[model samples]
Each structure stands twice: as C-alpha cells, then as structure tokens.
Target chain A: MLLVILELVGIAVFAASGALAAVRARLDVFGVTVLALATALGGGVIRDVLLGVHPPTSLTKWPYLLVPALTGLLVFSFHPQVARLRRAVQLLDAIGLGLFVTGGTSTALALGAPPYTACLIGMTTGIGGGAMRDVLLREIPLVLRREIYAVAALLGCLVVAGGSVLGLPEGPVALAGSALVVAVRLLALWRRWNAPVAHGLDA
Target chain B: MLLVILELVGIAVFAASGALAAVRARLDVFGVTVLALATALGGGVIRDVLLGVHPPTSLTKWPYLLVPALTGLLVFSFHPQVARLRRAVQLLDAIGLGLFVTGGTSTALALGAPPYTACLIGMTTGIGGGAMRDVLLREIPLVLRREIYAVAALLGCLVVAGGSVLGLPEGPVALAGSALVVAVRLLALWRRWNAPVAHGLDA
Candidate 1:
C-alpha cells in the first residue's frame, strides 16, 4: 500500500536522525545502532505494550530491526553527505513526524481506542522516540522545551479523525493530516515559536 | 521488619549515589532530583510494570519520592562532605546491591516466577538503575562490563533459592544471601577482578 511505503520512509528518516545524533555525540557503532533502534521503534513499542500487545510489532518482525540498524550503519558511513544538508535532514524529520502521527492515530482508532486516548497515543508515537533519545543523551528534549512538537501531532490526529468521521478515504485523509503537521512544524521552527513558560505557581 | 529496613536502606544509598552522580554530571537541581528518583526506584518501577501491577508502589508511597528528592537536595547543598569519602559511597553501593538482589529474587520467587527468571530479575533489580543511568548518559553500562557486576547478584540468587528450598527462615536466608553478595563484590573489587572477556568481542 502507498501508506505502508510512506510509513517505512518515515521510519527510515527517523532512524537516520537518531543515527546522526549519535554520531554527532561521538557514540560508537553499537551505540549508533542502539539509538536508531530506540528512535525508530521506541514509540511503537510503548504503544503496543500499553495496548497489551505482547512481543510488540518491532519484535514480531525482522524488518523493524534490520531497517533501523541498516539506516544507522548507512548514515554512519556517509556522515559527510548528510551533515552538509542539516536543513534537509530537519525537513525529512518533520515529514516523518507527520507520517508517524497519522499512522499511530489511525492504528489506535482502528483498534477501538477512545478518541482522547487515540489522540494521546498518536502524539506519543510521534514524539516519544525523540524524547527517549534526548533523555539518554543527557539533554533537555527539544520537543518538550522548544517547539510545537506534540501539538503538531495532535493537530494531525484531529485532521485524520475528522476526515474519517466524514467517510473520507484513508489515503487522502492521511495525506492531508501529514501535510498539516509538517507545515505547522516547519512554520514553528522558522518562527522560533515556543510554548509559554510556566510561572512559579503554575503547577 | 529487618528486610523492610534493608530495602529502605538500599533505596537511600542508591539515592545518595544518584545525587552524587548528578552533581558530578553538572545537572540542575530538578535534574539531580530526577536522576536520584530514577536511580533509587527505576528497577522496582520496571519490575512492577512488567508484572502488571497497576500504579506501582513507588507512586503509591509518598516517601518513595520524598526521600530521594530530599537526598538530592541535601547533597546539592553539601557536596564537599559527601565527596570527601568516595570509598564510603562505594561500600554503601555494594551493600545496596546485595540487598536489592536478595529482595528482588525472593519477591519474584514468592510471586511464582521460575528460578532462572527470578535470578535474572534479581540481577536487574540490583543494577537496573545504574544501567539506565549509563544508557541515559550515552555510554556502555558498567554492569555489562568491569568488576564482578551481575555475578554478585547471580550468586546471591542461588543462595537465597537454595536456602528457601531447605526450609530456612526467610530472615536468616535473606541475611546470609545479602552478606555473601557483599563479600563477593568486596573481594572482587579488592583483587581487581573481572569476568573473562572474549577477544574482539568487548563491543
């Protein structure tokens, strides 16, 4: 299916970002692969576990592991080419984020998740890997502190859900949803937008 | 009651180690507390989640959070005194490791886990926090290499299981197991001992 191809492309992009980050941090080959695996599959693993699906999609399939490992290895071998196009990497990352959020939302919805829960899962699926990567790297996560990260995922989820409720075809719905998320993220990054900082008594 | 005390002591010692490591890592106050919390309670959290226990014990008990947070704050304020005796910290860490392994193994056994699974859980309970810390710090885990490491936990689990099958009182059995692990780790450290390495396979 076209959707499946899009999903795989998204995964490859996400995994490459993880590998690139590890390389930038001076991690070895093993570490690069580990980070890529975590970044590409971490969100889905958490979602599956919470949904009570044992063995998870990653463990149930070989491509899930092989793809990320290969992506990391490839990125590591060709770091110079990738490093020169930082902007291109960011654009790909945003596109991957959009695709993943749509996939996660629709998957949860099809599995009979409540709307709010589906929305949460979708957002978590979109940003969870990046959060895990940042935590492991001892850095404040950019999504949590800087941009409209989870918000973009949520918007994508809303668009997909809205289209589904109107009996739209999944392909167009997913495409629209992904485009919305990618556009919002690109705009937010360009404008240096951020969520409001909480005051001393906010909590 | 003694076992409970030992568990609490283990938590406290690990909390201290977490705080010290956070300080050394140059984290902020909140970051220090977060590190301390993960170091002190992360193993139990993973155990409870894997066992399908809802609202893990660490969340149910306020002291579990309070103690580690307070420990981090204290260390943040008085780093000089704590840093003066690094050996004392190492000793406490070893004692905590013994208690954690013994406690986790017995808990798993009591919960009807198989012996090998119980032993694995025991090792995880003892070193899970440090492993998490290392992973988060973007390095190979110390537990995976160097010193006696997981061997201490494995030996302790054997003792605990053997004593339990022999109808020994839980108290004496746990105490003996804990002592054995502490002694093994101490002697190993004193002799600069390590598990055998396969050439070209350290990675």
Candidate 2:
C-alpha cells in the first residue's frame, strides 16, 4: 500500500516533467497528454514487460493511468505557475528516482530475475521514462549525456539486490536503499556533478 | 520457417541503419554496437514483452543479438563504403518495414491480443526501431517529422488485421500486406510525399 502511494507520487512528478516539456514545444493538448502518459508510465511498463507481465499494470490499472493524464492537463493550463515551482518539482523528482529504483529492483527480484539482471532492470526502470520523454522532445537523453542519474539508480538497486542476497529484511533495506538514492541524487544536483565525456573525441 | 528467415533479414537491415547513424554521430565502436542492437531488437522485444514473453527472444537468442553486433562492427570499419550504398540500404529498409508490420500483427494475433490492439502493436513494431535510432542520434524521428513511415506500417498492419477479420488466409494476407508496405514506402520516397504539420503553431 505504501509502495503504491510512492509510485503514484513518482508518476505525477515524472508526468510534470514530460508535460512541461511538451508545453515548451507548444504541442497540442493531445500531444501533451500522450507524452505525459509515456513519461509517467514508460519505465514501469518496460519493467513489467521484461518480467512478462501482460497488459502491464500501467495499461490495466486506472489510477496508474489517471494520475499522469490529469497532471498533464493541469500542467498544460498552468504551465507558468508550474514552471515557477521547478525547485519543488526537482526535490520531488529526486524522491521519485529513489522510489522507482528501489521499487523496481525488488519487484524484479520478486518476479524471479537474478540479482544482476534485477539491478540492471531496476536502473532502467528508474531512468527509462525520462529517456523516453527526451526522445519524444528530440533531445539526447540527459542521463546518457550529462546526468548522474543512472549511477545513482544503480547504487540504490545494488543496495536492494545486496539485501536480498544476504537474506536481510526487505523493508528496512528498501528504506535504506531509497535514502541512499535520494541523498546521492540531491548531492549530485547540488554539486552539479556530471559524468565525463570520452577523451579526444572532437580534438 | 520462411518468416524466421525474413525476420533475420529485417533485423540486419534495421541494424545497418542504426550503425550508419552511429557512424555519422562518430560514436565509439561499443556505442555503435549498442545502438545497432537497440534498433534491431527494440521492436520485437517490445512486442514480445506486451505479449507476456519473458526474456524476449532478443535477449534469450544468441543469433538475434549476434547479427546486429557484427553489423555494427562492419559499418564502423567501412562507413565510407557503406555510406555510398545508401540507396541499397533504403530499399532493404523498405522491405524490413514491410516484414516487421505484417509479422508483428500476426504474432500478436497468435498470442491472443484482440485485433485492434494487435494492429497498433504491429505498427509500433514496424516504426519503433527507427524511432529509437533517431532518439539515440539526437534527431527528431523521420517518421514523426517528415516521413510517411508510420502510416505505411499502419496500412500493412490494417491489411493483416482485416484479413483475419474477413476470414482470409494468413499467409497470403501477410504477403499482400508486406508488399503493400514496401510499395507505399518506395513510392513515398520517390514522390517526396509527407504528412502535413499542424497549422500555424509558430507561424
């Protein structure tokens, strides 16, 4: 029950990012809604698909679909106000990243994937929605280019996976893992830390 | 049996496009290979996932992974020569588009998806790889921006779906659908046909 609430909150934050992007692109309402849905659900959908869950929860569950759809419309109408709240959204986004990575890792673990694969899948689930949104908006994925996003997700996923391997309690471990991700992500953003580019590529 | 052969050929063609794009982007050998694999296998993997097939054939089957990896290496080594063969690649790409849509539709139908959902899946399967490639390359997908790509795929998918509805034989209908996609794609290229953009968004 708590996890579901976290997931919904994460979806709404992710959807806001997507909706704002679409608005900046001046997309029509339909396009904004579509992009919002894709950004909010793409990661979970990808994770579920990898786990062989048919008609993924995002597709079948009403709340999973509804939150993003409604959020998109709200953002579309009040984009200026929403844009002014960027800092708040970013904080929420960090929390969402933590939730998604930990949630995704444990879900994959429970669904029978090995630890390594679960870690990879969990990382993908944490990053996939933003990647899809960037693709739709015609930008190279920020995660692939500059952000510490995937690494942060991986760290959290590893914590979750390690807990399972050591037969530790899942709940405490998950909370710890989520905290690790949130801390790492917020620190990275505050410090403006970024991954390095390949050396001498254009030199 | 023939379908498998056709699928392999289609994957190779799609991989080539991805490799060429990666080469143009001046990505490293590993990056080129990664993009090729994503482009070649993304659609089928997505289809399989939606159908509840765990460890999608793209992941489980060595040959499926091998073809694109090898193709990427080959292109990376001889990109100039490969670039000169653009026309040939375009022709093969049309064929690939045909095979993917028809095959994707039938596979979904066989997997018990309703026809409407199957048609959407099939069209997605046909266009998904190219869309992914463009995203990785940091460009608007040609299919979304200027090409008649998705419509061509949809036409083929609808034929497959309609054939099933009308009680026509699968094999012949699939053949006809593939031919239709190929013909439409080639013709659109020759004629410089394009879909209209939304009116006066920035005008």
Candidate 3:
C-alpha cells in the first residue's frame, strides 16, 4: 500500500514537470497531455520493456494513465499559479526521484537482474521520463547537463544494490536508499551543485 | 538470410544518418557514436521490448553492436566527405525506412498483436530511431516535422497489416508493402511534399 502511494505521488510530480515543460514550450493541448503521459510513465515503461514485461503496466492500468492526464489538465488550466510554486514543485520532484530510484532498483533485483544492470536500470527509471520530456520539447535534458541529477540516482541505486548484495532486509535497505537519494538531491539543489561539464574538443 | 541482409542494410543507413546528425550538432566523437548506436538499434530494441523480449537482441548480440560502432567511427572520420553525398544518403534512408516498416509490422503480427497495434508498432520501428537521434541532438524529429516521413511508414504498415488481414502470402505482401513505402518516400522527396504543420497559435 505504501509502495503504491509512493508510485502515485511520483507519477503526479513527474506529470507536473512534463506539463510545465509543455507550457514553457507553448505546445498545444494535445502536446501537453502527451508530454505529461510520457514524463510520468516513460521511465517505468522503458524499465519494464528492458525487463521483458510485455504491455507495460502503465499502458494496461487505468489509474496510471488517468493520474497523469488529470495532472496535465490541471496544470494547463492553472499554469500561472503552478509556475509561481516552481521551488515547491522541484522539491516534490526530488522526493519522487528518491521513490522511483528505490522502487526501480528493488523491482530489477526481484527480477534477478545482475547488480550492475539493476543499478543502471534504477537510475534510468528515475531519469528517463524527464529526458523524454526534454527531448519532446526540443531541449537538452537537464539531467544530462546541469545539476547532480543522474549521479544522485546512481548513488541511490548503488546503495540499494550493495545492501541487497550484503543480504540486508529489503524494506530497510530500500528506505535507506531512498533517504540517500532525497538527501543528496536536496543538498545539491540548495548548494547549486552541478555535474562537471565536458571540457575541450575531444570530450 | 534475406531478412538478415535487409536488417543490416537498414542499420547501416540509419547509423549514417545518426552520425551526420551528430556532426551537424557539433558533437564530439562520443556523442557521434552514442547517436549512431541509438539510431541504428533503438527501434528494434523498442519493438522487442514491447513484445516482451528481454535484454533486447541488440544489447546482447555482438554484431548488432559492432556494425553501428564501426559505422559511427567511419562517419566521424569522414563526415565532410559523406555530407557531400547527401542525396545518396537520403535515397538509402528511404529504402531502409521501407524495409523496417514491413519487417516491424510483420513481426508484430506474427506475435499476435492486433492489426492496429501492429501498424502502429511498425511505424514506430521505422521512425523511432530517427526520432531518438533528433531528440538527443535537441531538435524536433524530422519525422514529426517536414517531409512525408511518418505518413510513408504508416502507409507501408497499413499495406502489410492489410495483407495479413486478407490472408495473403507473407513474403509477397511484405515485398509489395516495402516497395510501396520506398516509392512514396522517394516521390515525396523528389516532389518536395510535406505533412501539414499547424498554422495557428502556439504550435
């Protein structure tokens, strides 16, 4: 039940981000909805596909589709109000990132993927949606450029995978992993920490 | 045997297009190679995943990885010369588009997907890689913009799916479908045909 709630919250936050991106790009209503759906579900879909699950749960489940669609509609109707709370939204997004990373890692581990692949898939699950959103908006993905985004997810995945490898209990390990992600992400935001940019012509 | 050759040719053409896009974006060698790999195998990987195939063949198979990598390297070293033959590249790309559309649709049908779903998947397989390449380069996908790109793929898919619905022989139907796509795509290029763009507010 708690996991379900976490996933829903994560979907809502990601959907909000996607809607904001569409608004910023001045996209039409159809585009806004498409972006919202992609941002909220794209990562999970990608992960599921990588794991060989056909007809991704997101596609088959009604709530997964409804939540993002409604979120997009709400944002479209009151974007000005939403835009003013950008900081709050980013914080929520960070929380969502934490939840998604843990969920993804646990799921991959349960599916018997190698620790390394699990870690990578976990990180991808956290960042893939936003990357898809940016791509649709014709912009460089923020995760790939600025902030300690992908790195934070990676660290979270590493912790979770390491704990699992050590035979730690799943619940506690997942909690610890999520906490790590949230802490690192909030700290990076507060401190304006960024990943290093590639330097020189060969990078 | 024929299918293998067709797939290889498609990969090479798509990889070339990806390398050219990376070059146009002023990306370094790493970006070029990444784009090449994404464009060459992304669509098939996506299709496989949708069909519940785990660890996509492209990811596991050595040749799939090697062919695109080599193509990327070649393009990176001689992009200027390749760019000069833009017309030839487009011709090859059109052929690749046809082959991929037919292959994807047939594969989906064989997997027992609904005809509509098969058609959609086929179009996705034909266009998905290019779309990903454009997105990575921070550009609107060419398939989504100018030219009859997606439409050509859709038409090809329709023919393939339609034949299956009519209980026709797979080989002849697939061949005819591919021929239709190639003809339409090349005609569109020669005639400078384009899909209509929204002419209103906030496109």
Candidate 4:
C-alpha cells in the first residue's frame, strides 16, 4: 500500500516537472502532455521492459495513467503559479528521487536481476524519465550534466542491493535506503555540492 | 540467414551515422562510441523489451555489440573522409530504415502485439536509434522535423500489418514492406520532398 502511494507521488512529481519544462520551452498543449507523459512513465516503462514485464503498469493501469495525466494538465493550466513554487517542487522531486530509486532496486531484485545489475537498473530507472524529457526538449540530459542526481540514486541503489545481498528484510532496508537518498539529495542541494567536471572534454 | 545479414547491415549503417554525428558534434571518442552504440542497438533493445525479452541481444550477443563498437571507432578515426561519403551513407540509412521497420513489425507480430500496435512499434524501431542520437546531440529529432522518415516507416509497417491481417505469408510481406520503405525514403530525398511544417507551434 505504502509503496504504491510512493510510486504515484513520484510519478506525479515527475509529470509536473516535465509539464513545467514544456511550458518553459514554450511548447503547445499537446507537447506539454506528451513531455509530461514521457517524463513520468518513461523510467518505469524501461525498467519493466528490462525485467521482461509485458504491458507494464504505465501502459495498463488506470491510477498510474490518471495521476500523471492529471498532474500534467494541472501544471499546464497553472504554470505561472506552479513555476513560482520552484523550491517546493525541488523538495518534492528529491523525495520522488528517493522513492523511485528504492522502488526500482526492490523491483529489480524481485524480478531476479543480479545484485550489481539491479543497482545499475535502479539508477537507470531513477534517471530515465528526465533523460527522455530533456532529450525531447533538445537539451543535454540533466542527469549527465546536473549536480549529484545520478550519484545519489546510485548510492541509494547500492545500499538496497547490499542489504538484499546480506539477507536483510526488504521492507526496512528499502525504507532506510530511500531515506538516505532523500537526505543526500537534499543536503547536496542545500550545500550546492556537485561532482567535479571532467575537464574540458566532458561534453 | 538473409534476415541476420540484413540486420547486421542496418546496425552498421546506423552506427556509422551516429558516430559521424558525434564527430560532427565535436564529441570525444567515448561519446562517439556511446552514441554509435545507442543508434545501432537502441531500437532493437526497445522492441525486445516491449516484447518482454530479457537481456536484449544488444546486451548479450557478441556480434551485436562488436559491429557497432568497431563502426564507432572506425568512424571516429576517419571522420573527415567518411563524412565526405554523405550520399552513400544516406542511401544506406534509407535501407536501414526499411529493414528496421519491417523487422520491428514482424517481431511485434510474433510477440502477439495487435496489428496496429505492431505497426506503431515498427515505426518506433525504425526511428528510435536516430532519435536517441539526435537527442544526445541536443538537436531536434530529425524524424520529427526532416523528410518523410517516420511517415515512410509507418506506411511500410501498414503494408506489413495489412498483409498479415489478410493471411499473407510473412516472408514476402516483410520483403515487400522493406522495399516500399526504402523506395519512399529514397524518393523523398531525391525529389527534395518534405512534409509541410506546422506553422510556428511545432517547436
């Protein structure tokens, strides 16, 4: 129950972010909706596909579709007010990041991925949606360029994978892992810490 | 036997296009390799994933991995001369588009996707790699803006799907579909034909 809720929240936040980005880019209503759907659902779809799950929830379920679709439309309709709440959105995004990474890791484990591969897939799940949104917007992916986003997800995934490997119960370990990711992401944002750029050739 | 050969040729051409784009973007060798791999293998990976196939051929098969990796390196090493072969590459790309669309549709059909769904997936498979490359390169997806790329793929897929629905043989249907895609793509290029631009709002 809790996991389902968390997933919905994550999808809604991601959808809002994508819708806002489309608005910022001066996209039309259709564009906003498409970008939002891609941003909210792209990661999970990729993860499910990798795990060999057919007709992923993103494609088949009602709540999963409705939440993101509503969020995107709402964001599009009230973009000015939504944009003003940037800090709040960032905080929600941090929370979303936490939930998605932990959820992704657990799901990969459930699907019988090797621990290390699960860790990688978890990170991919966390970043995939935003990457799609950015790409469609004709921007270099923020995950590849932004501050500590993927690193935070990777670290969280590692913790989950490690716990799973050690025979720890999944529920508590996932909660702890998500908390850690949220903490690290928030702290990074608060401190303005970023991984060092890889010299002039990184681009 | 013939299908395997055609698939390899398509992958090589897509890889070369990606690597050439990377070079044109002034990306480093690593970036060139990554882009090339994504372009060559991305579509198939997506198609396989949607079909609930695990550890997609791109991840597990040696030939699938090697051809694109080598293509990227070779292109990076001899970009200037290769870039000069633009016309030849375009012709190859048209052939690749044909193969991918036909292959994708067939695979989807085999996996039990509905005829229309298979058609859409086929078009997706034909364009997904180039979309990834263009996105990574921070350019608008060429398929979304340029000549009749997606349209040609869609039309080809429709032929394949229509044939299947009519209980036609798969082999000849696919061959005919692929030929149609290639012909349309090449004719569009040769005749300087393009879809009319949406006024102002397409961006």
Candidate 5:
C-alpha cells in the first residue's frame, strides 16, 4: 500500500516536471504527452528491463499512460496557478525523488540484487526517467549536471542498506532513507548547489 | 549474406537520419551520438525484446554502440556536404526500408510467426528505429504521419509473402519488392503525400 501510494505520487510529480519542460520547449499537446510519459515511467522501464522483466509497467498498463496524460492536461490548464506554486513544486519533486530512490533500492534488494547493483538501481530509479525525458526534449540531463540530484538518490540507497544491516524495521528504514534524500535535495536547491563541468571531453 | 547486408545498410541510413535530426535540434556532439544510437538500433532492440532475445544488440556488440558515434562525428564534420546530397539520402533510406522489411518478415516467418504477424514485424523492422528516434526526440513518430512510410514497408512485406506463394526466385522477389517500395516513396515525396490524421485532434 505504501509502495503503491508513493509510486503514484512520484508519477504525478514527474509528470508535472515533464509538462513544464515541454512547455519550455514550445511543444504541443502530443509532445507534452510523450514527455510526461517518459518522465513518469522511464526509470521503471529501465529497471524492469535490467531485471529481465518483459513489457515494463508503462507499456503493460494503460493507467500508467493515462495518469501522465491527465497530469499534462492539468499542467496546461493551470499553468498560471502552478507558476505561483514554484516552491511547492520543488518540494514535491524532492519528495518524489526520495521515494523513487528508496523504492528502487528496496525492490532490487527484495529481488536479490547485490548492494552495489542495488545502489545503482536506486540512483537510476530516481533520475532515469527525468534523464530520458530531458534527452528527448533536447536538454541536458539534470542528474549528469549541476543538480546534486543523482547523488541524493545514491545517499538514500546507502542509508537504506545500512539501516537494513542494523535491523531497522522496513517502514522506518524506507522512511528514513527517503527523508534523507529529500533533505539533501532541498538543502542543495536552497544553496544553489551544482556539479563541476570542464572544457572538452572527459576520460 | 543478404540479411546481413540489408541490416547494415538500414543501420547506416538510420544513423545518418538520426545525425541530421540531432543537428537540426541544435544538439552537441554527445547528443548527436545518443540520437544516432537510438535511431539506428531502437527498432531491433524492441523486436529482440518482444522475441525474448536477451542482451539486445546495442549492449552485446561494442561495434553497434561505436558505429553510431562515429557516424555522428562524420556527419558533424561534413554536414554541409551531406546536406547537399539530401536526395541521395532519401533514396538510400527507401532502399534500406525495403530490404529491412523483407528481412524482418522472413525472420519472423522462419521463427514460426503467422503470416499476418510476420508482415507486421516486417513493417516494424523497417520503421521502428525512426519511430523510436522521433519519440525520444519528443516529436510525433515519423512513421505515424509521414507519407506512405508504413505502407511502403507493408507493400514490401506483402511482395515477399506473395512471391513465396507464386514460387518466384527469392532474389528476384526481393529485388522486385525493393524497387516497388522505392518507386512508391519517390512518387509520394514528389506529390507531397501524407497520411490522414484520422482522429482529427485540434492543432
């Protein structure tokens, strides 16, 4: 139940981000729907593929597709109202990222993936969809640049793994990891956090 | 031998298209490589997954990953010269699509897929990469609205199936199908053809 609720929340938040990004790119309704779908379900699709699960959730479930479309419509209809809630949107996005990372790690662990792989999955789960959406929108991926985004997800995964070793209850462990991620993201945003970029290609 | 040649030609054409599209979208070198990979290999990945093939070609072969990057660099360096040969690009793309459709259908048939399914697979094989590239680029799938794009593939598939029934030589049948598709595509382009947007969504 917790998983389902949090997953839906994450979808909604990501969908909003996707819609906003499409608007920034001057995309029409069709473009908006496609971007929202990528942002809302891309991470899950990648995780499922890596786990050898076929027909990932986005393709198998029509609701998963519809939810993003609805969110796109909402974003379009209430653009002005949403603009006024910029801080709220940022806070919700942080919460969504936290939940996604914890969910990815916990699910990978449950499925018997190793700690390192779980951490990678956790980070991907938080940011993969966003990265794909940005790439599709022809924008640089947020996680690969100056967002402090994927790092937060990585730290959340570490927290969860450590808590499990300490015999923490599953609920608290998940909650605590998620809280840490959210705190890091919010703090980073407040501080104008950024990753370093250099000239030319990297080794 | 034919299948391998056809697949290579299809990959090369799709890579060129991907590079051109990325450049038009104002993406840098890295972004062009990403688009090229998606455009040249995405359909095969989808087909392999649906057919339960593991470790999709893009992941299995370093060459498959590297070739697109090289193509991107080449295009980036010689874009002006390449752009002057746009007609040649279209002709190559048409030939590639015809061969890919036949190859895809024959493979599906050999794998015990029914005739109808085999034909559909053929069409998928021909246009799947471009569709995926457009989707990833946040554009309406080129196959979805482009002039007789899917139909051209479908015609080639039907010819292959029909030739088998008529006991025609495989080489002649394939040549005939390729010629037919190229003719149709050329005529469509000359006439400024397009598929009807049946749903009639508001602009």
Candidate 6:
C-alpha cells in the first residue's frame, strides 16, 4: 500500500516537472501531455522491457496512465501558479527520484536479475524520464550535468543491492535505500552541489 | 540468414549516421561512440524488450555489439573522407530504415501481436534509434520534424502487416515491404518531399 502511494506520488511529481518543461518550451497541449506521460512512465516502461515484462504495467494500468494525464492538464491550466513554487517542485522531484530508484532496484532483484544489472536499471529508472524530457526539450540532460543526481541514484541502488545480498528484509531494505537517496539528494541541493565537469571542457 | 545480413547492414548505416551527427555536434570520441551504439541498436533493443525478449540480442551477441563499436571507431578516424559522400550515406540510411521497419514488423507479427500493434512497433523500430541519437545530441528528433521519414516507415509496416494478413511467405513479404519503403524514401529525397508543418510554427 505504501509502495503504491509512493509510486503514484512519484508519477505525479515527475509529470508536473515534464509539464513545466513543456510550458517553458511553449509546446502545445498535445506536446505537454506527451511529455508528461513520457517523463512519468518512460523509465518504468524501459526497465520492465529490459526485464522481459511485456505490455509494461504503466501502459496497462489505468491509474498509472491517468495520473500523468491529469497532472499535465492541471499544470497546463495553472502553470503560472505552479512556476512560482519551483523550489517545492524540485524537492518533490528529489523525493520522486528516491522512490523510483528503490522501487526499480527491488523489482529488478525480484525478477532474478543479477545485482549489477539491477543497480544499473535502478539508476536508469531514477534518471531516464527526466533525461527523455530534457532531450525532447532539446537540452542536455540535467542528470548528466549539474547536481549529484545520478550519484544519489547509484547510492540508492547500492544500498538496495547490498541489503539484498546481506539477506535483509525487503521492506526495511527498500525504506533504507529510498531514505538514503532522498537524504543525499536533499543535501546536494542544500549545498548546491554539482558534479565535476571534464577538465578543459568547462565552457 | 537474410534477416541477419539485413540487420547488420542496418546497424552499420545507422551507426554511420550517428557518428556523423556526433561530429556535427563537436562531441568527444566517447560521445561519438556512445551515440553510434545508441543509434545502431536502440530501436532493435526496444523492439525486443517490447516483445518480452530479455537481455536483447544486441547485448548478448558479440557480433551485434562489435559491429557498432567498430563502425564508430572507423568513423571517428575517417569521418572527413566519409563526410564527403553525403549522398551515398543518405541512400544507405534509407535502405537501413526500410530494412529495420520490415524486419521489426515481421518479428512482431511472428510473435503473435495484433496487426495494429505490430505496425506501431515496426514504425517505432525504424525510427527509434535515430530519435535516440538526435536526443542524445540535444537536437529535436528529425523524424518528428521534417521529411516523409516516419510516413515511409509506417507505409513499410503497413505493407508487411497486410502481407502477413494475406498469408504470404515471410521472405517475399519482408522483401516487398522493405523494397517499398526504400523506393518511397529515395523518391521523397529526390523530389524533396517533406511533411507539412503546422502553419505559424515553422521556425
């Protein structure tokens, strides 16, 4: 039940981010909806596909699809108000990242994927949607640029994988992993932390 | 046997286009290689995943992985010379698009997908890699922007699905479908045919 709530919240927050990006790009309504759906569900769909799960749950489940659509509509209608709360949106995005990374890692492990693959998929799941959103908006992905986003995801994955290896209970392990990601991401934001750029390539 | 050859050819041509795009973006060698691999195998991998095939043949098969890597290296070293034959490269890209579309549609049909779903998957397979390449390079996807590219792919998919519905032999059906796509795409190029953009949004 908690996981389900987390999943919905993550989808809503991610969808909002996507809708904001679309507004920034001055996209039409259709474009806004497409970006919202892609941002909220693209990562999970990719992960499910990688795990050989057909008809990705996001596509088949009504709530998963509806949440993003509604979120997009809401954002489209009230973007000016939403834009003023950008800091809150960023915090929500960080929380979404944590939720998604933990959920992805646990799901991959349950499906019998190797630990390394699970970790990779977890990180991908946490970052893939935003990357797709940025790509569609014709911007370099933020995960590949500023902040410790991918690193935080990687840490979450590591925590989950390590806990599984140590025979930890699934519930506690997932909670710990998610908390770690959220904490790290929040700290990074608080400190204005940025990933190091390649030497001589900082322009 | 025929499919294998066609797949390799498609990968090579797609990788070449990706490499050229990376060059145009002034990306480093690592970026070029990454783009090449993504462009060459991204579509097929997405198709396989959607079909419930795990690990994707491209990742498991040595030759499949090697072909794109080698293509990237070759382009990185000889791009100036290769860039001179722009017309030839464009022709090869058309061939690759046709091959991938027919191949993807047939594969989806063989997997027992409905005709509509198969056609959608086929079009996705034909354009997914190039879209990913463009996204990675921070450009709007060409398929979504200009030309009769996606239309050509959709037509190929329709031909394949229609042939399957008629219970035609797979080999002949695939051949005819691919040939149609290549012919249409080449003609579009020669005639400078482009999909109409929304008025007042052409920038």
iRMS for all predictions?
Answer: 8.0, 4.8, 5.2, 5.6, 7.6, 5.5
**Per-residue accuracy of model 4 over A52-141 as CA lDDT, tens digit each:** 777465665668767987997788777877888989998988888888888998999998999998998898888999988888988888
Per-residue lDDT tens digits for candidate 1, residues A29-134, read 6557667877898777677667655335554465776788899888877777887798999899999999988888888888888767877888888888888777
Model 1 lDDT, residue A14, Cα: 88
Pairs in steric clash, model 6: none
Instruction: Please list the residue runs of candidate 2 whose C-alpha ends up more than 4 Å from where it truly belongs after superposition.
Output: A201-203, B1-44, B50-52, B57-131, B138-203
What local lDDT score does residue A162 receive in model 1, on the 0 to 100 scale?
Answer: 80
Query: Which prediction has the highest TM-score against the true structure?
Result: 5
In the range B1-203, model 5's lDDT, one tens digit per residue, is 76566677777788888988888888998888888888888777766664446777557977677776788788877888888899998887787788777877666666666555566556667777887778667775665446677667878989987876677777788778878888888888889876432121233
Residue A6 miss distance in model 6 (angstroms)? 15
- For candidate 2, write residues A1-203 as lDDT tens digits: 88789889999999999999999999999999999999999999888878877778889889998999999999999999999998888888888888889999999899888787687678778988988898888876666544477667879999999999999999999989989998888888889876533233333
Show where candidate 1 strays beyond 4 Å: A1-5, A49-56, A144-151, A183-203, B1-16, B22-37, B55-128, B131-203
Worst 10 residues of 4 chain A by lDDT: A26-35
Candidate 3 per-residue lDDT, tens place, A1-203, comes to 88888899999999999999999889988889989999999999988879876677889989999999999999999999999998999889988898888889889889887777687678778988988898777786666454677667978999999998999998888888888898898898899876432233242
True contacts kept of 1: 0.03
Q: Write the per-residue lDDT of candidate 5 for residues A73-159, one digit (tens) a residue.
A: 787666657757999989988998998889888888778888778878888888898887777766678777866887889889998
**Whole-model lDDT values for every prediction:** 0.79, 0.86, 0.85, 0.86, 0.77, 0.86
> Which regions of candidate 4 fall more than 4 Å away from where they truly are?
A52-57, A60-66, A196-203, B1-45, B52-109, B114-123, B126-130, B142-203
Model 3, range B1-203, lDDT digits (tens) per residue? Answer: 88888888889899999988777766656557667878999898888877766766665556776788899878888887788898999898998899989999999999999999999999889998998887787777888786788888989999999999999999899989988998998999999998666687675
Model 2: chain A TM-score against the true structure: 0.96
**Local error of candidate 1 at A121, Å?**
2.2
Instruction: Find the number of clashing residue pairs for candidate 4.
Output: 0
Error of 4 at A165 (Å): 3.5
Tell me how far the alpha carbon of residue B36 in candidate 6 is from the true structure, in angstroms, after superposition. 2.3
Ranking by DockQ: 2, 3, 6, 4, 5, 1
